[model samples]
Target: MELLKTLPAKEVIYSFSTLNPPVLHIRPGDTVAIETYDCFKNQIQSADQEVAAIDWNEINPATGPIFIEGAEYGDLLKVTIDELEIGTQGVMVTGPELGVMGHRLEQMESKIIPIKDGKAIFNERLHLPLNPMIGVIGVAPEGKPVSCGTPGPHGGNMDTKLITKGATLYFPVFTEGALFALGDFHAAMGDGEVSVSGIEVPGRATVTFDVIKGKHSKFPILQNSDGFAMLVSAMTLDEAVKTAVEETIDLLLPYTDMSVSEITMLMSAAGETQISQVVDPLVTVRFFVPQHVLDSLDIQLFS
Candidate 1:
C-alpha cells in the first residue's frame, strides 16, 4: 500500500543499503527498470580482459541502494526480475578457464559478439541465443567480503538463469539496510553456470518488487510465473541437494494434515528435487514444490 524509495545506478559502492530493513514496503505486481553494465567493471577496457587474467578487483559492479521503506532485519525481499536488457549493443568473452561442468573460461578467449540487425552474432560461426541474468545479486553481507563469483543463500552469485524475468527470489536480510547490490549481469548462461562465464553482455534490468516479514527460508525461493515454486542454492553439489530437500519437507509439512512421518513419506511423491550442477563447486539445486501448494502456505510464517 506504500510506495518506497527506489534507486537506479551503473556501478558498485561500499554499502548499497544503509538500513537493511526487512520489507520494501510496496505492493505486488509493480514493475520498474534496473540499470546494469558489463561484468568487467570497465576495468578491463578491451576484449583482452582474459580470464584468470581479470584483476577480480575491477569486475562485477552492481547498481544502487534501492532502499526498501519498511524493510527490517529478518524479513525476505521477494524480488521478481520482470525484464532484462542489454541496454547497449556489446558482448565479450575472454579466455576460458577450467571447466565447471564442461565450459572452460581460460581457453575460451574473449571475443566480441556483434549485434547487427538486432541480433547478436556469435563467433561468426554459430549464433548463441541471448538470455541475460545478473551474475551477482544479493543483500549486504554487513562486513563480509562476498565476491563476484560466490552466491549463497543471501542470494549473492547464484549464476542461475531461473532468477531471470518472472522468477521471484526471496533473499534474507542480514544487515539493517539489507544493503542490496546487484551486478555482473550476464547476457546468457547455462545450468551449472558451468561456463565460468556466459555471453557476457551489458544492460539494464526491470524488476517487480515486494517484501515479506515474520519468517524466512534457508535459500532463495523462486515462484516462477509458471505455477511452480522452487528452492535454489549455491552450496556444494551434495549439500545443495540436501538443503533443498530439507526445505521441501518443511514447506510441505505445514500445509498437509500429515505428521512429520507422513510428510516425509509424501516428499518422494508430492514433488521433486534435482541437482542443477555437479561441477560449479557451488552447485544449483532446485526443489520443485507445486505452486498450488505454495499458494496455500504463508511465506512470512516460514521465517
Candidate 2:
C-alpha cells in the first residue's frame, strides 16, 4: 500500500468550483494526517487581519486530494475519524448566510475558547467541551463537481461537531480514485449552525479509510462507537431533517435482526429518531439502539 508522503498547509486549495472534483489518491485502509488552519485562512494569525477579511470569493479552505486506489463510481467510501486537535484560540461568529437562514443573531454570540486536555474553554466566562468535527469532507461528483460550501451525499460542510473520533463516515463515490478533500475544522459547533460558524480553528487531525466495492449511498451516515447511527440530511432545513430520519431507518435496519418487513413493523410499533442539527442546512438524525439489538441483526447498509 502506498502512503501519503505529507500534507502541507501551503498546498491547501482555497476555492471550490467543480462537479467532477479533482482526484485524490490513497489506499483504502491507510490513515492520513492533515493540518487545519483557522477558517479565515490565517486571518487570526495575522493579527492585522480584519474579522471580515474573508472575501466572498475566498472563504474556507480544505486540505486534501487524498485518492483511494481502485475507487470508482457507484462505490461507497468509509472514512474513520482518528484524531482532531483544536487550536488554543478558537473563534465563533455570525455567518453572512443569516438573513437567508431566517435565524436571528441575537441568540448568536462570539466566543474565544482554549483547548486543553481535549476540552474547550468556551469563553472567559464559562466552559463548553467539544467533539471536534470536520465541517467539510467530500469527493467529486459524476460528470460535474460541487463546491465546498454545500454538504451533500459527497459530504461537505456537515458542521456536525459530534463526528468525533471513533466514528465512521460513509460517502458515495462518483468518480474514479474518489477524489477526497476535507477542511473547515470546527472546535465546537451548535446544531443548525445557525450563526454559520463555530469554534473555527486550525489544528492537525488524522483519519483512516475503508472502501466498499460496488456499493453506493444516497447520503452519508455515521455509526458511532457507542452503537448510535447518525443520518445526515443536507439542503433545505425541512428536507434535510426529513431525509435524515428516513435514512436513519435505512442505516438501522441493516444492522438489526429484523427483516425489511420486520423493521418496518417495528418502526410502526415504536421506533426512535432524534434531530441532531437544523442550522447547517444539514440536519442529522441520531438513531439510538442497544448493542443487544444489533447483536442478532443480519442487516447490512449500502448496496
* Candidate with best TM-score: 2
lDDT string, candidate 1, 1-303, tens digits: 644334455435423334433323334445556566677664444556554566767666666545555566788877877777674445555343444433433255556666555455776776667666676677765455555455566666666666677676777776554556677676656766554566666666777666688867667777675444445665566667777777767765665577877766656666777554443446667877665545554433344
User: Candidates' TM-scores?
Assistant: 0.77, 0.81
lDDT of 2 by residue, 1-303 (tens): 565445665546543333334434568788887776667665554334455555555567777666788887888988888887667777765634452353434433345567766667764666777767778777665554455665667677666665777777888887777777778888776655655677788877788888898766677667675554545555555665556556666767545556877776665555556555555544544444434445446444553
Model 2 ranges with Cα > 4 A deviation: 1-4, 14-24, 45-49, 95-111, 228-230, 248-262, 268-272, 281-291, 298-303
Q: Which ten residues in a row have the lowest lDDT in candidate 2?
A: 14-23
The regions of model 1 sitting more than 4 angstroms off are 1-9, 14-32, 42-55, 88-97, 101-108, 115-119, 228-235, 261-266, 274-281, 292-303
